[model samples]
Target chain A: MFEIFGIPSNALFGQLLIGLINGSFYALLSLGLAVIFGMLNIINFSHGAQYMMGAFAAYLMLKYSGLGYWPALIIAPLLVGITGVIVERLFLQWLYKLDHLYGLLLTFGLALIIEGVARNQLGSAGLPYVVPDELRGGQNLGFMFLPNYRAWVIVASLTICIATWFIIERTRLGAYLRAATENPALVRAFGINVPRIITLTYGFGVALAAFAGVMAAPIYNVSPQMGSELIIVVFAVVVIGGMGSILGAIVTGFGLGVVEGLTKVFFPEASNTVIFVIMAIVLLVRPAGLFGRRA
Target chain B: MEQRVAEPIATPEVQPTVWRTQSATILFVVMVVGLIVAPFFTYPLFLMQAMCFALFACAFNLLIGYVGLLSFGHALYFGWASYLSAYSAKAWGFTPELAILTGTATGAVLGLLAGSLAIRRQGIYFAMITLALAQMMFFFALQAKFTGGEDGIQAVPRGHLFGLIDLSKEMNMYIVVLVIFLAGFLFIYRIIHSPFGEVLKAIRENETRAISLGYKTDRYKLVAFVLSATLAGAAGGTKAIVLQLASLTDVNWPMSGEVVLMTLVGGLGTIFGPVLGSFIILVMQYKLAAVGEWVLVIQGVIFVACVLLFRRGIVGELANKLKIRL
Candidate 1:
């Protein structure tokens, strides 16, 4: 029953929780983007489409294959990641030597195709995605009631992001990836099979997005457009965080989400543009981004 | 491919002129004559729609073609201006010309802001930034009461032009649109040929080199952006008058994508590419409206094909084959 800033604590905490949940998604998606950018030197514009595919794949699995959320969580990412691999091999590999802009354009075209097909098949309406019975309810967390599904998303995304960081920063395979990113030719000289590694890295990044999509399906609507809108915000998050550092991406994603959530609670009119306002400020203050390395 | 870049010109050949120029001139003449004669064949409303989009694409081409900046958020200006003009004409009951001027000025200001913010980044970042900014505008349009929510500002009046010409008449409106397109097209042609346009190309080719050479590249970019945006607003304002309505569809991201597809299909960095692209795409859409999302898929395919094998575009490719810079 306590109040803060003339608003109930319960309402404030609830929005904060929602903000954190959204942040987890931002962190996960941006993290994937950074990893892919590190290796490919291309921003994957189809990331959102692949994410949509992830949710749709999960929806289809449940509808026909009789699989539950538990299995689809693993299966969806795998299928989508394989699709990424195929795309990389068939189309993206050709652009390695071209202008980075071409890569962006090609991926954009692919995204349009994927999204268009989904829209045609599914129509524009959102389909219901029920949370797993195990994760269905809420917990009274002293000051606020927290939805278990949302809590699971936050925890799971945080765990995945940290694990990815640890793997990249603290392991041998991570060392190879970091080294390859620094100099692929040099890495290949050491018998690292750089091209295959690059393909796999793309696949892994897409897989990360798919995982987030699967996680988001139950919370958000399973629709064709679910990712298209979300991806732009993630792009802004990447810009603010600086694609140069993974940890920076993770932190900025969560921080911005909380800022956005707090804005919704205090000044709902500016809630939609709060992140953009921050981005404009960031650009003015530090064009290189918060964590970008100055060339 | 690498060898093609290595081949040097032993002798500078005179740039050959081709039929594209003649054909384009002929087409322009035909289009003008057709517009003058269009009332007899097509509905005035349909011709107005085509002219509006054609002008929009032409304006859009100024930036992407000559300047090499692919702005994905131009729909923001187009949509915003449509709203402003619609509001001015309908709510305040201003003359059509005055309302259009108001919309154009709004577009110039928006262009100035967005261009300044977006020019900081280059290449893909630039595209993404513009896209994000446009999305921000979209959200603003959605929340703002003036846009009339989902319904948009309905029944916007086609007020008299200059308090003399009645734009409510189908024949009168067609002439206004045709004149506007001609003026806008000539204005773009003038800009491209001016020394200012040369600076834009230099900046596009190599910004650092241009900066090092002591050209104020950012100012030139801003000017180009403003011009492009203001013209797009003119197109949007004209559209509002023709349709007698303004809606959210004008400012949405898909509208943004639609313009990009137009420029790509017509030709990037070419004078008349967008005009050609706009007509081709509009005709296709009209025919395939019932094909559902396949239009999007087909558009995507064209985008990919253009970027990969047809980067020069229809006009650009023809110009290249004939050794002309048309």
Candidate 2:
């Protein structure tokens, strides 16, 4: 009957692919969050808005500049990254001395402003972005048909995630970043421009979120409200992964996505809430998160 | 990565002087009188709605102000309580008091579960965990049969209070809401000024020191969390009964943000601040109802302005300038 667990093989594989796609975004977004949190000590609550901005940047580019997907992909993240630089320079700089909660609150306010402005302009409905011409078709694997764009999203996200990990874990700049996160005074004493590094790190992290947004534009509708709920899911993923190690963020992201995919097939109703349920359990058992250093 | 504590409340150990007592009494009387008389001047429903939010904001203020725990998911308690109470009132033929009590109890139970999980982590993690849990409950509400799937539990009968006084009469319902609000407000005031409140303040100032002082700081935080949730639930139950409906607006993240905004605008630690904040925000919402998303923008602007320039908030600044606590 080509059935596994009373579900068709195609349907099962299809949902798993969807889950992997979602997981790729989660890994990219969470990686950015961890990197930003590492350097700035701010949670960057406007991250979702920045992700939404990336999609909007692509849309605007295509509309006016007649830019295609690839060009928009490179340019959109740069544009959104510039905005993140502005945000860090203006509002976020003042909050470095205050409570961590203030950063969360301030960025939350920024998120609201960005989303609200977008909604006011765009009218809350989703706008469709065409899949790139090169990645428009699908391949019929023996078990399931996989769309090229979605597969591209997965591969591209994974590559970027690993590249980011390599940069942070192996490179000298990432060493400076890890050092700066631990002690800004020490880093400053070493004659490195810590403030500039902080600014750059925030920008880079935001760029990562925007990059995910551009990739997501084809698979999901580009809307003002798109990143709002997705951001919460990412938050749960962060909590599960512990936001400590780069690899932790990546592994947890994909793992949970597969688990969610399985849940969709088996339980269906819990598909929306399974991560949260797991989050509660993890919080109860290991409050430090899976990869977080025990305090 | 950095873990810095919130700013401490500059409590100067208010010595109870005779002048202070007289002034406080007079101020309290004037406030109660203003609230009573003001309803007649403007729309009564608006004032009632203001009172509901006032209670909600005050409940939220208790945790952030005293314990330094910013719960970003308070809407779960408020909205779920409203749903349970609304369901009981309309479907189960429960009295108004019973229904509201059901809602309040629901908040307490939820607080116990969420608090235990959240209190494990300090600062930002606490906020995140609470938010995640609240979102979880929100999904549950969205799908569950009793929540009416987005249309929400509508046209809930307010029924009668204690099976005698008819709540259908607007004046009667208003009085009940007013009395309930006053009771909750005074109850919160007592909690803040009590010895327990002092320990909560001590913990806010330095949690490790409080722990070293032989106080089970976690228990104190948990109790305070439950009390705040219960009060918020009471507020929500009152609101559902007054509005004759319970909807997703009550349980959404935006609703939680609005409560935080109200609390921030009024004053973080001041007893009278949340009520003032609630009135201001409620009026703003009513005026901006036509502009739609612009309200969100304005709220965002206020949040930024408050965090950046007006950290002490309206009442906190006034208290600072006047050299007296509100």
Candidate 3:
């Protein structure tokens, strides 16, 4: 019954909800990137692929093991996190001494390998993960119908993002991470096992990505190419947010998502490119990023 | 610290002798001769494709190798040029040479715009900025009607070169591509050896030092970026004529990644590295065509190997270990 600028309120609310959901994923992923970059000084190009792996991990859990969604959520991230630890130990360790570019290239290669292997084993057609019975229904809010699963995804991702923030910004372990990121040699001199911390931090960052992946599986198609498609936009978010602050990553991710959703309503043609256009403008205005310290 | 100090001293002494080596001269001649004669034995289309990609990679190498600036969005220039050249030749009915020139000019203008914006950031941020800008271009290409959307500009006419020589013939097209490749290659080589290149190299080696030493480092970087972009566009334009199409594949992020991969596999800083890298990658793609998606896996494996163990690349490692310039 209500309309703003001649557009129905339901359609607007619906897009905003979708935008918020997309933003939740962006926040989760970019947060993971910022955390990883904090310690490793490497942009994990495979974050998207790892996210996809998280989804597939859930898919495999259900298809072969007959485990339900809840258990898979717990198990998938751990499995993917373990793989992340292996990747860090086996390959990424050597690149820390080289230019940061090598880290980008190396991770890019890993992403290709993961995506390629997945594509080879499971074809490109996206497989749907069924929404669990408990979260299957929707509620009529008078203005719009809100799906329970969608609301759950928003809540779960927000909780995880906040929890991650609390751990890094408030906890003792977070203090060690912040200290080590500032001066690894000094932290090593302080008798902390910095390498182990580095390894675990990478795993934790990747686990965050995996968690987001599991959340995304029910909404988006579980496809091999899924990660590559989303990772670039996340990179833009990281750029815009200025990987210097964790909270920045969270705010920018969700904010950009809503902006993108709004674009779809007003100028549908520019929705795909609006973030990138904003990125250029931000670079022009503040090259250090909104939250980043000058490099 | 001592070993690090010794490296700079050792490099200058060895550089001149390596550049003038008898084998290096022979290698150059042999390569030229091989290029001139290869079309007779090999498929011209395949050769043309290799040459186009080789030129593209070389153009990419100019920035990363000499300028120490990695651009991840080179596909914007390459892909945009292909689209423009294809459109001009087909829609506007221009000659092949004019169409390619038009594409190159477009690439230069884009380079100026993107280069000015991207160079504001350094290292990792620079790479991301270029990539983001390129993605913007990709989205534009996807939506713009002139690019023909997903179908791309197909069946682009291989118009006559200069309105004199017919380019529809395979041999004619091959010759034109070869000429373009050689010109681009030799031009890059010449630039590298020039005094301007020396300044660019200095900037790459140490930007603060170069700036402190009174060099207008940003301007030099922008010029190099534009030049590199222009050549990449020229290559893409030439390829459009050869393939008679300009598609989204040329402008997408994957193509940008592929060029970076080629540069890495061949050798990042070496002159001939990209050429060898392109051949190796293209050959692998051809041989592994039946294997479907495994090619990406193999390429990824090569990337890991190159980063971890073979950072110097094939040409770079050989040049280092053998004490000979490639």
Off by over 4 Å in 2: B1-24
lDDT of all predictions:
0.85, 0.89, 0.90
lDDT of 2 by residue, B1-326 (tens): 33323343455457867654465456678889998998789988888899999999999999998788999999999999999999999999999999999999999999889988989888877888888899999999999999998899999998999999999988899999999999999999899889999999888888888999999999999999999999999999999999999999899898999999999988887777889999999999999999999998899889989999987788877766655667
Ranking by TM-score: 2, 3, 1
What is each candidate's DockQ, to 2 decimals?
Answer: 0.56, 0.65, 0.60
Measured as a fraction from 0 to 1, the native contacts recovered by model 2 come to 0.65
Query: Best candidate, lDDT-wise?
Result: 3
Top candidate by TM-score: 2
Instruction: Write the residue-wise lDDT of candidate 1 on A155-241 in tens digits.
Output: 999999999999999999999999999998899999999999999999999999999999999989999889888888998898788
Write one digit per residue (lDDT tens) for candidate 2, span A1-295: 2899789999899889988988898899999999998888788788999999999999888988899899989999999999999999999999888888888889889999999999998879999999999998999988889899888998999999999999999999989988998899999999999999999999999999999999999889899988888888888898888877999999999888888988898899999999999999998888899999875
Model no. 2, DockQ: 0.65
- Model 3, span B1-326: residue lDDT tens: 01010012113235555444655566667778998999889888998999999999999999998888889999999999999999999999989999999889888999999999999888888888898899899999998999999999999989788898998898888888988998999999899989999998888777888999999999999999999999999989988889999999999999999999999998887888899899889989999999999999999999999888887788887777766666
Question: Cα lDDT of model 3 overall?
Answer: 0.90
Clashing pairs in 1: B65-B269
